[model samples]
Target chain A: MAYERKIGDTILSVDQISLAFGGVKALSNISFSVNQHEVFAIIGPNGAGKSSMLNCINGFYHPQEGTITFKGNTRRHVRPSEAAREGIARTFQNIALFKGMTTLDNIMTGRNTKMHKNIFWQALRFGPAEKEEMEHREVVERVIDFLEIEAIRKTPVGTLPYGLQKRVELGRALAAEPDLLLLDEPMAGMNLEEKQDMCRFILDVNDEFGTTIVLIEHDMGVVMDISDRVVVLDYGKKLADGTPDEVRSNQAVIDAYLGVAHDDAEE
Target chain B: MFYREAGQFKTSYRADQGILTIVQDRFVIGAFAFVAFCVVPFFINDYWANAILIHVLVYVLAALGLNILTGYCGQVSLGTGGFMAVGAYASYKLITAFPEMNFIVAILMSGGITAAVGVVFGLPSLRIKGFYLAVATLAAQFFLVWVFNKFGWFFNYSPTGMIVSPPREVFGFLVTGPQASPEARYLFCLSFVVVFALAAKNIVRGRVGRSWMAIRDMDIAAELIGIRPLEAKLTAFAVSSFYIGVAGALYFNVWLGSAEPTEAFDINQSFFVLFIIIIGGLGSILGSFLGAAFMVLVPITLKTVMVDGFGFAVGAAKHAEVMLLGTLIILFLIVEPHGLARLWQILKEKLRRWPFPY
Candidate 1:
């Protein structure tokens, strides 16, 4: 709390993005902009294209219509690896930790983009490769300490509980030292305590790293408390985008959540 | 009590990240190396070398290759034997074309050639996965064998379709052809296996290995984390093929002395290496060695027990060997799918705890 976190100019802007799977529209004309060092939340009902929107931003799902401008580079056909190179890293809704690998290794893998020692040197396992690995291992160990999962450092993530797995996934994304972090339901299926822990971690990451977060969460209370701005989507369309107070008072978002009154039913 | 690491501590990440981090492990490996490099050569004879040591080393090299592709990279390849054939034939052509070329260079270049072939076959992996990719590689297996079989050029227009290894030497020691000593042959193959196995271990523990595992575990997430699928899968294929190719080169030049492609490097050869990784423990470097040893030792042990001890006919014993291997593969799959390497790890874990119930 000693150092104030400031929200800066727009770092990512989605302009009229529309995505469809055959006849079904996953997201239609959805547009939003995220400012630097801000927690931007996307909350929507089930099947409201919440994941699809994240997918689009991360280049997993390419929009048929608009362009996504990230760090001033507009792209419609960005590959996920390219997006990652451009400083976008993410955790999946279902924890995507490398199950066979230890937690330490899973987090170390997040530093894949940073490490550049080639296959030949890696085979040698000496000089540059050894130095690179040790340096990255130090960074990964710090991430492990920060996430407070040092106890499970060598444990295979497949055997870990859901809450811990989610935390480890966050640890993996954090290990990348990403500029833009995409977290899909980082606290889903967790108890209140776990949710609180996750909220603290997310806020800490934002404050400590000054990372721009694009989070998709269904928890309204956590969303309103932590997010600088919230976007609501329904039926693959953006309903509202504003500060939590503004969106909370919007009648359209209310109707989208609570069904609208049918006046014709009185007839 | 001996294996306990109660007082030992690592002060640097470099020390901590070493492949043999445990003091006891380094000592054990050092002992094993001493036995392998120094002790084995002294006690070796034609029967031991040809029947067990040479065969096991060759299979270990091949299995390590396949394990890199199938185990570490999570890419199933049935083209291993075919790739090995490419190595054998390439080495044959290289040695014959440039008779003055060093045998080591010839073997390495053969490995390089197989790596290129592996990359070409690996291209389809970018589009397909799992069983479909397996089928694609299976096609490579059949097609490669067919090419070797049909082409007389591979055999250098040999009248009987047999490519024989012309006598080759390294430091005044005959390593290839019929005149090669069993000790020399074993040592030569052993040297390649030791160096390559170490290299394989290093590669699998590094960034390239991490990328391969990342793609294997969850490719979508891997891609999102900046690991390219094309690079990971293809590199797996190339590295795997390189090891297999080197194994093939040794198999021909040092062990067999002469090989017929269709007979030597066939579908059964492919399945043989596959079974090694399955029973040895998939995705483990030690498993590759353990699996290859298990595979090579099992049949030999079965034959010795059945034919030599029980006085069973050699032909019948061979049939029993095949049947027992099938049963063992199934047993390993059902009971401990992680294979012999996992069993070894479990034993080490128990050893560390000793009498403590906890």
Candidate 2:
């Protein structure tokens, strides 16, 4: 199903970002922007500094030279918490769900930002904390319902299937209600059915919530099917930036990311 | 069938969401509270009240503290003895300096002091974890004990180098000192334990608890997810120390009446609380009580059987008791790693499956 994306002003942009460890460059003068309510894809072969670009955006890594502009406000560094506070929530490349916690608790944890009660109230858990928890719990329950993970609400994430664990992680990020959601390989290790489910959810999250998404997915087919725009990274550099069809037809992207043999065979 | 919840469905969120969700669980907790507050105080002899009941209550408080840190928060600290020492000394100071101070105020002040010390000791946790953090916390244990042992001001320069709790009253009832009856002291400690346990349960069931667990599971991810690791770990340390501190205050003021550093807040106290959580079930509030109970009773029972049933010498029986307790703990853990809590859960499950396989 085609999920229409209403393009708006740029929600996030990177300007001439170059990150390196000692002399080895991880990302070199790479720049791309995510427009509001757009499903933006960052696709690259393995070791193409795809994750590094995400790290820079989220403030986990401080680039030697770069400016990150989020909501038209540019800054030298955006700390992860700062980014989260400013409505940038992310899922990890490797599912980082709290393994010991139930799916509900893990999602509720994402509501940490909205919870205003302090230790005094939390310790009592009657007046303020209970009220806040229940209120946030309503939002989390909605996320769980939307994701169709109601059955695993009480189950620990450690025991869940890999695909479900990924979904729970997504739920956790969504529970935060960020304006821009960063999903790093959200459906990395999943069967075709699971991937389809994840794809539909991602599209629905974008379409229904009108959330701008920055997605890093290796699967070109899924990326092309869902993302409104594609940014191809190769050798720590921006290779191509356009719509999926334009990126698909780019010779450099086909050779560096899609493989020359595959492209020729397809042609 | 009696254990089954087939007809006890929750009709409200409050009913469904609580420390005791099942109706049977609520009943069990209610019954236990009644037995503790009303029945035990009336029936227990001085020996049971002073030597056993009060001691168990105090240890339960301490174990609850340690479990929150090591069990739930995943920040291991071998500083229970040290933190408790902070509480003991702080309470002693508060009691001695302000003779007009209420016992409750002194205990709370001591908890605050210990929380400060705990936060200081906990700072390194942000930079380190696992055994290294454990080893670093041991420094706090050794240093705190040494501070109390070496400093005359701590004990008020008493020739015996021990601090004695002055007599204090709560609501026209003697709660501390030699004049206090066993029941007075027992009730005092019991009240504190019950309150602390409730607060602990409440905290762990809510936002603070989730943040601590998130940091425990994955600190990096927790940070990215907006949980401040520094805040979470330090809060764990502060809160854990606060409870342990109150236990120390009770241990000195109500139970022992006088505390010598080596004899009172030693490394053994730390290991004992660690064993409590291991035997009770880590990350479960009910485990703290069960573990403390198991630890307190098993030793006394072993000693009684060794001395009476076997005609062993008192010293030999003491040694034999320790060995037997050790053996039992090992066997119990080997059989069910989640401890007595898991055992109780298993029993409940079996009861639910009465007359049929589940």
| Tens-digit per-residue lDDT, A138-163, candidate 2 | 89989999999999999989999999
- lDDT string for model 1 (A1-267, tens) is 355788999999999999999999999999899999999999988899999999999999989999999999998989999999889999999888899999989999999999999999999998999999989998999999889999999899999999999999999999999999999999889999999999999999999899999999989999999999999999899999999999999987888787779732211
DockQ, each predicted model: 0.87, 0.76
TM-score, candidate 2, is 0.97
- Runs of candidate 2 exceeding 4 Å displacement: A1-4, A258-267
Best by DockQ: 1
Tens digits of lDDT, candidate 2, B204-307: 88889999999889888888888878888999999999999998988888888899998798999989999999999988888999999999998988888888
Where is model 1 chain B poorest over a 10-residue stretch in terms of lDDT? B1-10
Give RMSD (Å) of candidate 1 vs. truth: 1.9
- Model 1, clash count? 0
